[model samples]
Every structure is written in structure tokens, then in C-alpha cells.
Target chain A: MSDTKTKKKRKEKPPIEEPLLAPGHRACSGCGESLGAKLVMDAAGPNTYATCCTGCLEVFSTPYPESAWKMPWIHSLFENSSAVAAGIEAALIAQGRDKDVNIIAMGGDGGTADIGIGCLSGMLERGHNILYVCFDNEAYMNTGVQRSGLTPFDARTSTSPPGKRSWGNKTTKKNLPGIAGAHGIPYVATATVGYPNDLINKVKKALKIQGPKYMQVHVPCPLGWIHPTDQTIEIAKLAVLTGLIPIYEMEYGEVTRVRKIGKNRRPVEDYLKPQGRFRHLFAKGAEAEEELEKIRQIAEDNIKKFGLA
Target chain B: MARPRPAGYVAEPGSSKANKTGSWRTEKPVFLHDTCTDCRICVLVCPDGIIFGADSIYDADFDFCKGCGICAAECPVDDIEMAPEVR
Candidate 1:
């Protein structure tokens, strides 16, 4: 009788109202982009133009002539989605039809954090009214997970292969939100599919903003990630808990608010473990895990450095 | 007997994050000398090559720091923390 039996009730999040990106589409079982796109469509659909860069979303959603999208959709090259969206906005604005249409430029990490950045930056600087959402699955998933600027270091991708001498993805994931903030856009926010309500809230916010706005959604890919299909949300939740990815919002080139940090941020390993993507860390005679821990530490630093809490 | 749920705040539903702040992406790092052991862990751990100095002390080039805290972790003691809440 000495032990206090305490049963904490599960925080019953209200039932998610409706589905946006319907089923029967072909996406990898654990595709984070799919989940992210679902939230985007729910907030920006029925009267929006969705443009995707040539990547996994493009390949899967539009498998040559037979597309799964019922909405107005367009597929363009890797580095020009922004420019194309800009042109669409111009045409709409010129025709005095801007109030009715919403344009969203979607791409992977390679496109936004790398090739498509220049155009995306231009669109924001020009104050083009478009919602640019990047589903960051870390690397170029379609082109074989190469070490793109957004790919985190020490994580094994096809190109950033672990070898006897080199670590996986030597460089860090480029700060896309921070980079986008510099343009002095009307709005900017970061979200993850794990928190659908918050993610949807952000997309709604981005859509309501007058000038250009950006939303970087953390989408964990099972293909390049080496994680599981079921634990996609959990791993993502861990990312925020460990301060690896701080959910935040910025306005006019300034950070405004951040999500509260979970109480127990038990080292980086707590976030790194339980996934095959970080399996090498526990392997015998390898500092790969140690190196990853450093990354986790870096993520924690981001929280303190940014005052995410 | 009951367990306590942690106090965490969430953005109101259907609300917008349109508030403008004085600065964006400007997270300045402050060193807590009293808490610092001066182990120089930060000196070696800085991803950007900007945290070196004599006597194992460290300095961050905010322009170049990129706000990536290899230095904060490098500090053997918890000497480095984020600046106090401000614009």
C-alpha cells in the first residue's frame, strides 16, 4: 500500500475531422511526405493549385499519365517549382483572380534546401503570394539518398554510404526556415506530420498570409531513413522532444513563437535508437553511434540557442 | 493516487501565427562563466571553425556560428546556455 498507484489518463486529442489525400494511392508504407501532404491538402484544397518538384511525390502521385490527384496539380523540374509557381501567381494576379486561387510549391530536401532555393528565395523576396511547403525526408529520395545539403551527417543514405573512413552525410542539414526567414517574407513556420493539428494550423496560417510564406514540414522517410513504417510518428515525436527539430513560427524575417519542449530530453540516443536508420550506432567497434550522439547534442543546442520552449 | 500531466501550452485551435517579432533566426549564445569549467570542449566541437582562443577559452562568431552548437556540447561543463529571453 506504500506505492501510490497513479494512472495518468491519455490526452484524448479530438478525432481528426476528415481525410484529404484519399487512399488507394501508391506511396511507400512509411512515406513521411504522404502524411505531410495530407495535412497540406486539407488546409489548401478544393480551390488550390498544387505543384510538386520532380521527386518521390511527383513519381508516386503521378505515375505517368495516370495521376491520383483529383485537385488541380502540376509537376515540374527539380529546380524550377518556385519559378513556375511564381508565374502561376502572376497570371492569376494579372487576371484579377488571385483571391480565388492558392498556389503551393512542394519539393523534397534536395529541391528546396539545394537546387530550388534560388528561385524559392526570389519568389519570397518579390513578395509573391504562394505557400512553399518542403517535405524534408532528409535527402534526395528519388535520386538515391545522396548527401544533399539537408541530409543530416552520420546518417547512411545511398550516396552518403558508411565506409571504413568516412561518416555518412558529412555536412549538417541546412537551416531552411532560417534561410527562408532572411527574405523578409510575411510568414514562415515549421511543422511535423506527427502533430497533425499543429501542422494543419500552420498551413492554414501560411495560406492566410498576404505575401509569400514558407512551411518546412519534417517528414521522415522509411526508404532512405532505415526506420519503420509504424513508428514514423513516434520517431518524429522524438525529434521534437530531443530538440532536434524545434517547431517554430517566424514573421517578416523574425522568429515569433515556439512549441513547448517535453520535460525529459534524455540524450540524443533516446531519439536515435529504436530505428534501423541509426542501427550502426549500436554495432560493434563503431563510433558511428557516438557521432550521431553529437548530432543529437547539436539538436539540443538548437533548442537552447533558439529558446524553443 | 494520480500522476500529474506536465504543463505545456499549445497554440489555440484555428489561430494564426502571424505575430511579428523584432528579429528572426537571431539566437545569440551567452557563456555562463560561473558554471563554466573552461574544459574547452566547445573549442574543439564547433562545427564552424570559429570557437578557438588562448588558454582553452572559446568565442562564437555569431555571423559565422550558424547557431549550430558543437561548442556548447564541447564544453565539458554546462558553461554555455542560450541568452535570456528577449527580442
Candidate 2:
């Protein structure tokens, strides 16, 4: 056989056989959340049941008479997806089908970091055999871009607009992975749409482990972040490369792996400049520079904390 | 095609495959077969799941592809390019 043919023969097969998440749903063009969700679903394979909270994913995937999900999927209230998934797990166990099926609970940052946190905590504490995936778009994008707990500092959302007395959202993004790790879950991972391979691998690995697993995926929103739709992956990549969002996995309350930034590590400005939500911090003056310094320091802190250097 | 009954009602699982979302695209991805490595990353990463084919060959179903260049971006070989739609 030729070299190319031999290489093809030696290549490992892709996990997904048929598309589990079908097309024709209403997700916006270049939606990082939808893309990341599909990657996760594909990696988890067909023998999975997903529970989605009332957010962009649920809205787009199930628009009456239409559903993108081919497998068993449930849409629950904004704050009860994890609880619903726990119920599903209980039922599966009752029927002795727990080993054959995987349970997944998914939600946006608004649902995961804020509204749904209480139920999420219960699900984690109960140690259900479920994987909870939070698509962190940083704001409540479905509801006119209101500020959510995951909204980063100095971001301009509808509820956190900049003014003379206010500098956008006056708080840092919540460390959800850290919170999940504190729950003593067997697996906790932070991923982004920028790295599909890493995201897929982590999802696959998480599914193999028993008990609760939490994954926080950074998904950029073009409408909320005010970036061109085409730059979705670019912005996501910059977010990780700049060390603003450290990609890592924790097992049993200890970080076991960190996706390094490598030689192409960039400054925080490179990640912040593309998104218009951070535009106010880029004005040609001293105040803007000061705020920029603070944001840069956050990235520096992440680098040091995760040992990304 | 009948109108949807109400908010709580659902048709069939994966019925969204009937909704053609191609018109939403302002740009479309064109696969460069020459530079393609057949890694299937585009097929794997496409949000719409419109890209198909196995091994070293692939094609897209433009009827549902919303032109989310996620495929183009994730293509390791830089084999997919996004082009502005003529319309």
C-alpha cells in the first residue's frame, strides 16, 4: 500500500457514526454554544439522554414540531435541568438501564452559574451518574443580553452598561469549575469551542467515569459580545491563548491537566480588542489604560494559577 | 406542512431536519479538496451537522448549512474557506 493509504488504515476511527444532533435548528450562524454542544453530543455517542435548561440551546433546538436531538432529550425549567437529569438517572437505575445510557444536563451560564446553581449543587452533592455541561457565554444572551454571574468584569451588558458611575459589570466571572471541583466530583473540566479536539476528548473521558462530572465550556456569543460571526472561533482561541480562560481538568478536587498556551501566548488585549463589549476599556486615555491593566492582571493571575507559562 | 399546534407540543424527534436554514447564511464554506487531509474535523465540528462523508472525502448539505465557519476554523489542514454569498 502507498504511504497515504497506510496512514489512513492506521488512523483511529472517529467516535460518532451517524449525526445525533440533526440540522435545521434555529441557532444563529456561528453560534459557539451550538457547535460546542454538538461536539459534546457526538463524542458522548447515541446512547445518551440530555436534559437542557430553558436557554438558547433549548430555544433553538426545540421550536415546536421540531427538535435537533435524535436521542432521548428533555427540556426542563431554567433552574431545574440538573434536577431533572437526576430524576432521569433515578428512573434509569430503577429500570436497570443505567449502565446502558448516559445522562447529561446542560444549560447556559445564566442557568448554570446563577439561577440553576442551587439545583446543580444538589445534583452534585447527591452524586448522580450524570454529566453537567455549562455553556458559558458569559451573559444571559437569550434575554436581551442581561448580566449573569459569569459575565466578566468591565463587560457591557444590557444590565451592566458603562456610565459615569459604573464600569459595566463590576465583578469577575465566577469560577464554576473551581466550584464543581469543590463538590468533590470525580471529573471537572474547562473547555472552549476553540479547541474541538480537547473538548471532545474531555467529554468522552468524563462519560467513562462514574458519579457526577462537570464541564464548563466557554462559548462566545456574536450578538452579545458584538463581534463578527466569522470571528467566533478566533475570539475563542484568543481567549485561551491569552490565558484569560485557562483550560484544565480536575479530578477529585485536584487539577490533573492544563492545556498549555505554548509559545504563542498572547496578551489579554488581543483577546479583549475583538469583542465590542470590551470597547470602552480601549479608549485612548489614562482611565481606559488603568482598567485595561486590571483586566490584563486577571489574565496574568490565571496564567500563574494554572501554570500556563 | 401544517402549523405547529402550540408551545408545549412536539412533532417527532429530530424533525428539525425538515427546516431548511441555508438562507440564513451571509457566507458559505467551500471545501478545498486538494489541501484537505480528510481528518473529518469539519464534519465533527459543524454545528448544523451538514457536512458528511468519511475517510478522506467530504461534502456539505447546503440546504441546512448555516455557514457557521466552525468547520473551516477547525479544519487542521486549512482545507475549508468561507466565501461571501453572491446573493
Candidate 3:
């Protein structure tokens, strides 16, 4: 009998695995949105209260009889997660328990950048002590792929399908981070699902600050974007490396930190070719070249504006 | 008699654990622990949050893993591989 085996195994530390988001959620495999939510929730920790708008997160995490959230969470209307969070903040303040509680409002791009913009602006303007996270997958994913205000230029959706005369969506992504910063909030940042550590850091940083904070996390959708399920993180990284989705932070209307792409910056085609939504942009024609050049210019503009080089 | 419903609200948190999402997988990840480092990158990137364990002893909970192959795809040391799920 080998007594050394028993002695060596005497004190191995127990595994620590307590996710704030429980399993069995209906989010698709390799769903970037769910990963983003889990990262955010894990960062916020157990002593948090959250409100989710009616979008992919809310629908998938909380069906009629079950909820995946491990904290006190509320599901409200499609356009009022911010309002619900504001109300919760007010109630907590009146009860003198606001200082110890972390409040978060979660939504998809359609809920945050489009339909919910009014309430979100109000939440920011009124200086509510909360963090609002917009998981931007670039379209209205829960309701079949429809175009959203935050959808990037020339990306095809059900509503913006490319035809002989059409080049998908005509408008560029809305300046959401800029709009949030213009309100002069305490903290505003952008993150992506590919970089989990960075995403967690931003969420933790936002919770520590007082007053309103905003974070827009770029989440890839396997079902909607039509990329391979395993490539969610890879595609998300491509978005940043190509300098399209600028990762930066603002404090009180001033830029503080920007994730530099520098010499490792990649071309837009590496990103666009992988996504079916951007497939039309890669067609062998003058229109495709024109659209790609426009997308490249947009990335270059972002690099120049944020000093990402 | 009808069940007593109070304003259509759920009191239980994390109840989705009963849904058994693992059945959705057509492929499952197999870990080669010998080549594994203690990076925990696979644990962090898992969308389902079902990969558990600390250090180099990590493994996925097959009860909920949707087998997205992210763990294998993102493994820095090539410690994980996606294999076809066997009946």
C-alpha cells in the first residue's frame, strides 16, 4: 500500500465555481451575449440588483417559470430597464441602503440604443447611481434579425437585405458611447466579449464609481451574424483588431484609456469575410469594393479619433 | 382548484438549472489534462458557465455544457478537443 498517495492528496483545495449566472439558460451555444452577461454579473458579484429589458438576455435567461440570474433581478418592458433601475435606486436610497448595493440595467442594442434611448438618457441626465450595460449584437436579434440603430453600415439583416440596388443598411452605427459621454457621466466605457478580463475590469470599475455609468459590450450572435458557433470570441476579437469597434473609456466627458491596436491592426476583410451579415460586402464587384473601402475609412477614422495607432 | 398565483412573479433564482441544456450539443469537448496549464481561459470564455474546477484539474459539467467548442478553440495550450458526442 502506498501511503505517499494518501499524504499527497491530503489538502488539495476545493474547486471554486459559483457563477452569478446559472446554467440551463436558453442562449444559443457560443452566444456572445450570454457570455457578456455572465462576465458582467460575475464581476458585479452577489450583492447586486439588476434589471433587464425585453431582449435576448431577458428572454433567454428568464422564461415563464425559471430564471438563470443568481441575484435579485427584474424583467420590465422593452424600453424601460433604465427606468426600473432608477426606481430601484431611489427606493434603495430612501431606505438608506443604497451605499452598499450595486445596481445594473441590462439590455440589447435595440433596447438601449433605439427604443429605450429616451429613458436611458433620462437615467443618465438625472444622475442615477446605476450601471447600464448594452450588449450590442448589432441588430434586433430576439425578434428575427432586424435592423437596429446601432447596426453598422452595409451589414445585412432581414430588414436590410442587400439587393441589386441595395447595399444593406445605409446608416453607420450610432455614436452611443459619444452620446453617453456627452451627458458628463462619471464613467463610460466600451468592451467586447472576446476580451473577458477587460470586460470584467470595466464592469467592476463602473460599479465602484458613484452616479451613472455606461458600458457598451460588443457581443457576436451565432444565429444572427451567421458565424460558426465556436468563433464567437474570435470574431469579437477580429472586430477590435480591425479597429472597427474602438475600446476606450471616458470619465466626465474626457477620454482616459484606449486599447491600442497599433502595428498589429488587421484589415477589414478578415473581419467582414467571416460574418454572413457582411457577406454582400465581399462580393466581387465595384459596389463591394466601394462599401469595403468605406468600412476601412470608418476604421481609420476611429483609429485617428481615438489615437489607437 | 387553480394554483395560487401572486402577480405572476417567480421567487426562485437560478431555477434554469433544471432545463438540461446539455442535450443540445452534437459535439463534446474532451480535455487532455496532461497538456493543460492553470490558465482558466476556458472557464472564463464558456458561454454556459458550466466549466468548473481550479488549477489544472478543470472539466466541464456535462449536465449543462452545450458543447460550443469554445474551450477547445480558445485553449492556449491545445489541451482541449471537440469530439462527436456519442449516444
Candidate 4:
């Protein structure tokens, strides 16, 4: 017994031999979606299957002759990743292997909050044993920065360009986590790539639960967001700290845990000024001030709704 | 003549490792090990996922390191600096 105790005490942290998401994929330098994908797969471990929609994640990781994923992965159309995952789960159940394997469905905001939302809703309503992860970069980044349903108000996109008669995007971001929680699933959570440990822990916890689980990870795109490539993590953290993005957990349509902003709450400009996409909002005009106030109000509303104070 | 694989499935998984992305790097991260705290934030933040180490010894596999500078930018101890690539 004493020798066993010594051995346990002397155990060292094991070195990582091979990342589940291997390197040499064609993701741009400092791409937050790739990091988020790696974190999710690392948390899910070796006995998991992943299905991805047609988006940047699928494109960059799986060019014609090569693939970065080290696990069993599949890709379907832009709007059927969740449906494909449901099929995988059904097959596993037929084989009496459902309990041993985990299923994950992944897509970008364009695929998740826009085109794939119907399939995602069906999967959630059917109560499949799967986790759906939405990598929300706030636009259709794979197709050259077109605006999507999750795009925030007054953010510039190729389609929503600011011109003589219009601001950037006219509509506010859809409350996707709320919509996911509305399905009364077992687990729903919002996370950002800024906090890696929190993100990993949430993924692990969601995988442990048996019912439908949803996670929307705020992955910043340096090219799309027009920020310095090295500033991806900083920009992501700023989004949370500025109260524009509230990190919280929901269980069965109720908020259970929230990452409190407290004294660290910053104004939205701290988050906006760094990205060139929001540059038009800073131009000198009374209209700009009004729009900035509206954006601030959105952040304030989020802080109040999630009780982040 | 041969038929193509179904849905273009990869016969060898993780074959992207063969594509050396290090050539895309304009700047390379130089690690100052003497002052390193071994927090491993560099490993966590790397989009390339090329850094690997354990027990206070961390280093990046230069073969796949795209030198995004995220590791250096996120390093709390300032032990990493993005220097211009010499070669």
C-alpha cells in the first residue's frame, strides 16, 4: 500500500503525443475556429465521431488530397450536419453501441444559425444523444464575409456595406442560445475561444449528459473581423469583458451559471475599435453616436438578462 | 480505370501532417526558456496545435508551426517573442 501511494504521488503529467486535430491544415494564422475545433475534439477524446457542415471548418481542414482530423469524420451539405449526426446516432443505437460512442455536429454561424437551423431544431426536438457546436464568427466567412442571421447590428459585411443611405447590418444578432434552450434540452451553453479551460470543461460536461446538448462558441475570424491575426484571443476576451457576449450555462430552459462581469465591465468601443469591420461606427457624426448607443443598449440588455453583474 | 472512393474519404487519416505549413510563417516564435513559467498557454492558444510538452519543458514542432504569434501574444510570462524568420 505504501509503495502504491508513492507511485501515485510521483505520477507526472503525460505529454500530448498527437492532437486529435492534427497540424498542417490550411486554416489561416490565428484562426479562432481551428483552435476551437481542436479544443472541442481534445475534450471529446478518441471514441467520438464528428459531422461537419459545408463551411470554413470543412474546407480548410479537408482539402482534396488531405485531412487534418484524426477521428472518424463526415461532411454533408450546409444544412444537414445535425441530421447526419442524428443518422449516426440511430445507427449506433441499432448496433447497441450508442452508449459507448459520442456524436458531435459542427458548423459555422452561417450554417448553424441560418441554413441549418431547421435541421438543428429537428435534431434537438427529437432528443438525439448528440452535441451540436456552432462556431459563430458572426458572418458567412467561408464565402467572403457575407452577412448571416447571427451577424450583429451595424457590422460591415460585403453584402451589408455602409453607404450613403444605410448603416452596416440592419438587424441585431439572433438569440441562438435562447432558441436552443427553448427546446428544453438537457444542456445549453455559450462559450468563447478566449477562455480555453472553461470551453473544454463545458464540452466535457455536455458530453457526459445523455440528451441533446448545444454549445455556441464565439470564434473570432481575423480576416473576416479585420483584426490583427495575433489579436484573436485578445479580441475574443474583449467581447466577453465588454458585456457584448455573456458566457453562461442553461439547463432545461433556465440559466444556472453565469460568468459575472462585475467591476471588469468595459464599454463596447473597447471591443469594436479593434476590428475594422466596425470602423464605420466610429466616423464623426450624430448618427454614429446614435448607433453606438444602440449597440451599448444591446450589451446592457445582455448583462441584465444573464445577470452577469 | 478505377472508381473513386466514396465521398472522397481519406485512406490515411491525419495526412495533412505531410503538408509543411511552416513555410507560410513570416515571423517565428523564439522561446526564452530561462524565464519560462511553463504555464502552457502557448500550447492551448496555438491554432496550429503544434506545441507539445510536459513537466516544464515545452516546445513547438517547427515543421507545422505557422508562426501565428498567438502563443507569443497570449504568453503571460513574455517568454515568447515573434522574430522575423531568417531563412
> For every model shown, what is its TM-score relative to the native structure?
0.72, 0.92, 0.95, 0.95
User: Which TM-score value belongs to model 2?
Assistant: 0.92
RMSD for each model, in Å, please? 19.5, 3.7, 3.7, 4.2
Q: Write the per-residue lDDT of candidate 4 for residues A55-138, one digit (tens) a residue.
A: 999999998888899999999899999999999999999999887788999999999999999999999999999999999999
Off by over 4 Å in 4: A1-11, B1-7
Q: List the residue pairs that clash in candidate 1.
A: A254-B23, A254-B24, A255-B24, B41-B74, B42-B74, B42-B75
Which is the winner by DockQ between candidate 2 and candidate 4? 4
- What are the TM values for chain B, all candidates? 0.52, 0.81, 0.88, 0.84
- Per-residue alpha-carbon lDDT of model 2 for A203-260, expressed as tens digits? 9999999999999999999989999877888899999999989999999999999999
All candidates: DockQ: 0.01, 0.50, 0.54, 0.54
lDDT string for model 1 (A50-83, tens) is: 7788888777665543555556667668888888
Evaluate model 4 with DockQ and give the value. 0.54
For model 1 the local lDDT of residue A62 reads 59
Superior candidate under DockQ, 1 versus 3: 3
**Model 4 alpha-carbon miss at residue A284, Å:** 1.3
Between which residue pairs do clashes occur in model 3?
A: none
Q: Which ten residues in a row have the lowest lDDT in candidate 3 chain A?
A: A1-10
1 or 3, greater by TM-score: 3
Order the candidate numbers by DockQ, best to worst. 3, 4, 2, 1
